[model samples]
Target: MSNNGGNGGGSVLATFEAGTQGWSGTSLAGGPWSTTAWSSQGSRSLQGDITMSAGSQHYLLKSGSTNFTGYTKLRATVKGASWGSYGSGLGVKLFVKHGSSYAWKDSGWVTISAGGLANLTLDLAGVNLADIKEYGIQFIGASNASGTTAVYVDNVVLGN
Candidate 1:
């Protein structure tokens, strides 16, 4: 999928093949989430696992200051396992930095089917791309699931 990491009309923003590439894993909502590396599309993939669980656990992979001006979309190849139910258990979202003081724009929500690999894209058409600081994935509605929920991320590329 994704033309093997090709962004169709734009240059690749990041591949994360160089060891996280300034991105870091965050256990949001104090969820028992941890990160590890595995193989994806013949390269290394970052895997986020909910090793433990709290009610409504949340987690994110975040980093900053990419200057993504002019880019209108973000593409990410991912796979999910467990993640509870689509509505009440495990859900995913894409967010972009907004304005000068580091606010966030909730770009869109991604649907994660249990144990499925998906190539998903998000629109960045309306945001102030000129002031973009960063972009990342956030897990939402993780309350009903146990520690078995996991998401693997790879080939996260930004494009026009």
Candidate 2:
């Protein structure tokens, strides 16, 4: 996989084709374990049931060909489910790795508390991508909070 041109003028390095069913079977770097979709704590939300469990369900992505030197930007579009009292509420955590056995460090988290859609972005300003071996997206929430909350994610892009 190659890094996408910062100006949005190059080919895609890698992409997860989330089908209508809301789940993708591919791994981060052709790994063995399959990354599951989003999970809910209660009834299934309308945003499309793609969620993680209270603990598991973290998805990893390898940069492959793209390596960053300076500032980089990552963005994604997501739709939250309209279930429960607050509807489809969720939080996303971003992580980055520097080496093969290195642990994933938290970059940031974006919370979606409404029933509508929201756009999230994070700036990798001082991160060193040279040693970044893998990046991950994890869902964090409480039990009884309706793990069945649905979510729709698309158009994940990175730039430098």
**Top candidate when judged by lDDT against the true structure:** 1
What is the per-residue lDDT of model 1 for residues 34-65, given as tens digits with 9 covering 90 to 100? 23444455566666655434345344555655
In model 1, which residue pairs have backbone atoms overlapping below 3 Å? 56-143
TM for candidate 1 is 0.73
Model 1 worst lDDT run, 10 consecutive residues: 28-37
Q: Write the per-residue lDDT of candidate 2 for residues 29-132, one digit (tens) a residue.
A: 22212123332211221123444444324353444324645437655555555753333345665556655566456547676674656555556665566666
Which window of ten consecutive residues has the lowest lDDT sum in model 2? 38-47
Question: Candidates' lDDT values, in order?
Answer: 0.60, 0.45
Candidate 1 regions exceeding 4 Å error are 1-4, 28-40, 51-57, 82-89
Task: State which candidate has the highest TM-score.
Answer: 1
Q: What number of clashing residue pairs does each candidate have, in the order they appear? A: 1, 18
Cα displacement (angstroms), candidate 1, residue 40, comes to 4.8
Error of 1 at 55 (Å): 6.1
lDDT of candidate model 2 versus the reference? 0.45
What value does the lDDT take at residue 64 in candidate 2?
Answer: 38
